[model samples]
Target: MIVCVAIVGHQNNPLYIQSFTEGDDALKLHHVVHCSLDVVDERVNNPKKSGPMLNETYLGLLYPTENYKVYGYLTNTKVKFILVTTDLDIKDADVRNFFRKFHAAYVDAVSNPFHVPGKKITSKTFAERISTIVKAFGLSSAG
Candidate 1:
């Protein structure tokens, strides 16, 4: 199950952070995502030099905690999708699908006339979209 989701800006600042874990574990989940940023940064700068780079967005599993694993996807515009899941062995396709849906939601949010690119997303409809994504994927819920 997904424990947290984060939308990180190009400059490494978190634009949005959603914790799916209940109570104190939420804090721990945030830290896990925060630490995973370093791995995302490294992968962005020095991507695997061997394989055919069809779409360099999916960075794969960044790192693992005892209870969760962090997965990262970087958009062309440099926004990041950081997903923390309780399952350590989550499939790459699942992560990709989630990020794909997330990307669409992000685009929709940014397309709003009053929305700013780097600011935190506060749209109720956008939040609902994300919540639906979590439910569709049988993810955990926040406290």
Candidate 2:
């Protein structure tokens, strides 16, 4: 199941974060997402190992934790979508599906005239859509 989600800007700064697990672990989850940036950077610079980075926007697995596995997707504009889940053996196609939906939601969020680029997303529509998407992964907000 997806336990946490984050949208980060090109500068490595977090724009939004949502967690499906209870407690004050959002901070910890943020660190987890932040650390994954290095992996994204590695793949970005060494694109060959990951195939044609220009065509394949999905960066796939960023890293795995004892309790969760992190997946990352990069946009041409340098924005990033990071997802953390307990499902260690998730398929690449499934991750791609998640990112495809997420990218659309992200685009919708940023396209809003009221939205300020690189800022936290506060759109209820975006949040609701994400809540539904996360439901497919089996959750919304934990506590």
Candidate 3:
């Protein structure tokens, strides 16, 4: 069975949420969201080779009014990762809508891909399209 976990935290803080599947050495996955690129990069690239290492990827989200941005990371159960960020002027509504669409597309695209692993998501058009959808959803001004 699949498990769903959600976490809520300040945009300026480190946020983490995890879920565990059932089986032998089942997936112990964790999702961490941070507001700083430097902090996230340091934690992911730290040389303290003790526990499992994470496979990382990055994405960027942009908001054109507030001069603020948000970065995200989607990691594997064995510490695999996907990182993303916004450019600037990011509004809360824009961020929320982006995740709503991004999460939907992830379930449809990534989960359905027949590749092995370590595939990077570098589609700027896709990101932009998603951003447009977010704006169309009336979330661009809700905040």
Candidate 4:
């Protein structure tokens, strides 16, 4: 199951971060997400280390810890989306699907006239959509 989701800016500043699991591990999850940023940097900086096309937004599995697997997606605008899940064997298609939906939600959230770029996302509607998406994760087959 997804334990955490994060949106970070190009400067490594967090825009949004949420943890679904109920426990004291929110800090741990946050640390894990933070550490994954370096991996994302490495992958983006050294394209030869990654197998996929350089232009692809999906960076695939960033790394796996004893209990969580982290995935990353990079936008053309240099925004980064991070996903942390306990399901270590999750399918690539599922992760891709999550990013696609999440990115759309992010775009919609930022499109608001009052939203300032680089500011934290505070839209309640966006939060609700993210909650819905997280709850529906892995329930349907990805195309």
Candidate 5:
């Protein structure tokens, strides 16, 4: 299951962060997300010389803790999307799909005329869409 989803800005500032797990794990998850940013930066700066992934946005699984796995996606505009999931055996395609849908939702949210760039996302519609997306995670690609 997905425990957290975060959107970090180009400057490494957090644009949005939401936790799906219960209890006080939110702080730990936030720390995990923050730490993953360094990895993202390193990957973006020092990409592989040869491979299809050289220009791909999906960074795949950044790192996996004993209890959770972190995945990252970087947009052409430099926005970063983070996903923390408890499922250890998840497929790469599933993670990619999740990021794709999540990214689309994010784009729609920020497209609002009232949305100030770099500001925290506070739209109820965005929250609802995110909630729906989170709940639907991994369900579509099950085969």
Candidate 6:
């Protein structure tokens, strides 16, 4: 059975989750923070020897120490999905100011109750909202 995992997040930050079954070193190490699931981690970290670059990137940030949440879940069939919400805190006044225009659109519009779990998020409203937010924050060039 093919397990599908969908990760949706705010415009400024995007999540990268790699499947261990695919044997690409560059793709595995690229933008991956950490693997919560044991099997995934073992395949990427142990056998592949991808090093601690992901953890280093995550821990090396200069942001204040706080419990910034990373969103993720495992399906009943054991497929995992993860979302990295923000690279840094949105609580900072300057950061919040930068994202103010997109705040409502993110917290309310895209993540609304109508969007069901485990489903591919293809809402035009959501996409448009993200595009507006990205442009407003000058994050169009951001990866």
**Candidate 4 residue spans exceeding 4 A from truth:** 49-52, 141-143
For candidate 5, list the clashing residue pairs, or say none. Answer: none
In model 5, where do residues sit more than 4 Å from their true spots? 138-143
How well is each residue in 22-134 modelled by candidate 1, as lDDT tens digits? 66687777788889888988886776666676458888888877777888889999998998888746667777888899899989999999998788989999988998898
Ranking by lDDT: 4, 5, 2, 1, 3, 6
Instruction: Please list the C-alpha lDDT of all candidates, in the order they appear.
Output: 0.83, 0.84, 0.37, 0.92, 0.91, 0.36
Angstrom error at residue 135, model 4? 0.8
**Model 3, runs deviating above 4 Å:** 1-36, 41-68, 71-94, 122-131, 134-139
Question: Which of the two candidates, 4 or 5, achieves a greater TM-score against the reference?
Answer: 5
Model 1 regions lying over 4 Å from their true place: 139-143
lDDT of 4 by residue, 1-143 (tens): 89999999989999999999988899999999999999999988888854458779999999999999999999999999999998856778888999999999999999999999999999999999999999889465322
lDDT of 3 by residue, 1-143 (tens): 11212222223232222232344321322222222344444555673444443443222331111422334434333221222322334454554544556556544444545632335333455445544554454444444
TM-score of 5: 0.95
lDDT of 2 at 80: 87
What's model 1's lDDT at 48? 68
Candidate 6 lDDT over residue span 3-94, tens digit each: 11123332212232222223354343223334324333343345433565433212111222133323333322333344323345333333
Task: Report the lDDT tens digits of candidate 2 across residue range 1-143.
Answer: 88898888989878878998877788888788888999999888877663355557788888898888999999989998999988756668777888899999889889999999878899999999997888875532322
RMSD of each: 3.3, 3.5, 15.9, 2.2, 1.4, 13.2
TM-score of 3: 0.34
